[model samples]
Target chain A: MAGVKALVALSFSGAIGLTFLMLGCALEDYGVYWPLFVLLFHAISPLPHFIAKRVTYDSDAASSACRELAYFFTTGIVVSAFGFPVILARVAVIKWGACGLVLAGNAVIFLTIQGFFLVFGRGDDFSWEQW
Target chain B: MAGFLDNFRWPECECIDWSERRNAVASVVAGILFFTGWWIMIDAAVVYPKPEQLNHTFHTCGVFSTLAFFMINAVSNAQVRGDSYETGCLGRTGARVWLFIGFMLMFGSLIASMWILFGAYVTQNTDVYPGLAVFFQNALIFFSTLIYKFGRTEELWT
Candidate 1:
């Protein structure tokens, strides 16, 4: 029941995030789709962790190089996602208001991703590892 | 050799212990620096789209620096020290050579960025923003690579 509730909450938050993203891109005031490129960042942000989890064995060590490298790449992806909208606005490819909306979406989306990982990654019956 | 090197060494700060979070923190810091460097360069590129405004050649420094970052980190510290990675063709010597080449690439890019900054922009009395961007990109990546290499506790696992 708790897992199901978490899933519902996560999905709701994700929907809100995507709504912001779509509004930023599709709104009449900000009629540019460049902010949609951030969707690519959102897609790949958690990939490094997934890869690392598969490649490295569970160990008692403080940290493995594999995990650290994954973390590094994940951080890079997340920062790039945030930087994308700002650069777009700076270059006049998008408006500042659109950038703000996209950034808010980015934060919410990334948090949703984090929440998904936390809620589903714990190796329970609903664990993402099973996928 | 130790005595001579000690002469140049700064007083050690033992306050920072090797906590478990050190690896994650350092890696995240390095990643931020690396991406920030790239994003700054991209900003410069977008702002000054003409090659005459900012030469396309200036980006090579950043590319090489990025290559160096990967090269330097590809070899584990244990591998360089003749430990866990003994099965390679050249073993520890190979790791050391790889590291040396990586360092060379990193420093070479850094110096090249400085040259581009001063020789092309500063000396010519042209706009310095683009050149400064190029320099900062390489510098940030270089520092990021250095921090990634030395900022963590590798021995904690070994």
Candidate 2:
């Protein structure tokens, strides 16, 4: 019962995140879809970790240069995602309201992503081929 | 392989294992550097006067620095620390030479940034905000790369 509750909660949060992202881009006051570029960022942010996890099997040690490099890349991507909207706002390409909305969405989305990782990470190994 | 993992060094301590904390801080620093780069680059891109040539110069130099930063950290600490451990095509001195080249590229980026700051931003009597941003961004990248080098966990060759 609790497991189902958790899944439901996670799904709800994910929906909220997507709603925030869409609203930022589609709101009549903001009226700019450029903030949607951050969706690309969402796709990319987790990729380095996935690749690093795949390539390096030793779960005990996190000190591998290859793994660290992957972490570095991931951090870079995350940081860029945060900054992109501000730049758009600064340039007048997107309104300040849209930028703030996108930032909020970014926070929510990233949190959801991390939460999903923590919740499902264990089972992922068993279902590796499915992924 | 075992010997390579042995080369991952810690800053000799007696009481606490600072590894995790160190890694966390370094990751944050790298993120900060990445933010700095993005902010500066976009600022250059958006500025009204749009000093096109100067913008290109700063960007080219910034790209060089970032590439060098990646090059330096991508090489393993095992290859960097010990002379006897090299088994690659560059011979015993190969690792050392590569490290030197990486450092030189990083420094070259710094110098190029300064050159542009003085030539394009300062002499022209324009606002210093953009030039300063680019310079600090480059510097932050240098520091971020350096920190990333030191932040790693204990590994075993086996």
Off by over 4 Å in 2: A122-124, A127-131, B1-18, B83-86, B153-158
Instruction: Compute the TM-score of each model's chain A versus the native chain A and list the values.
Output: 0.92, 0.87
Which is the leading candidate under DockQ? Answer: 1
Question: Lowest lDDT 10-mer window, candidate 2 chain A?
Answer: A122-131
CAPRI rating of model 1: medium
State the lDDT of candidate 1 residue by residue for B55-87, as single tens digits.
Answer: 998999999999999999998888888878347
Report how far residue A60 has shifted in candidate 2, in Å: 3.3
Q: Tens-digit lDDT track for model 1 on A1-131?
A: 78788889999999999999999999999999989999999999999998988887766677788888999999999999999999999999999999999999999999999999887885745554334
Pairs in clash, predicted candidate 2: none
Residue pair clashes in candidate 1: none
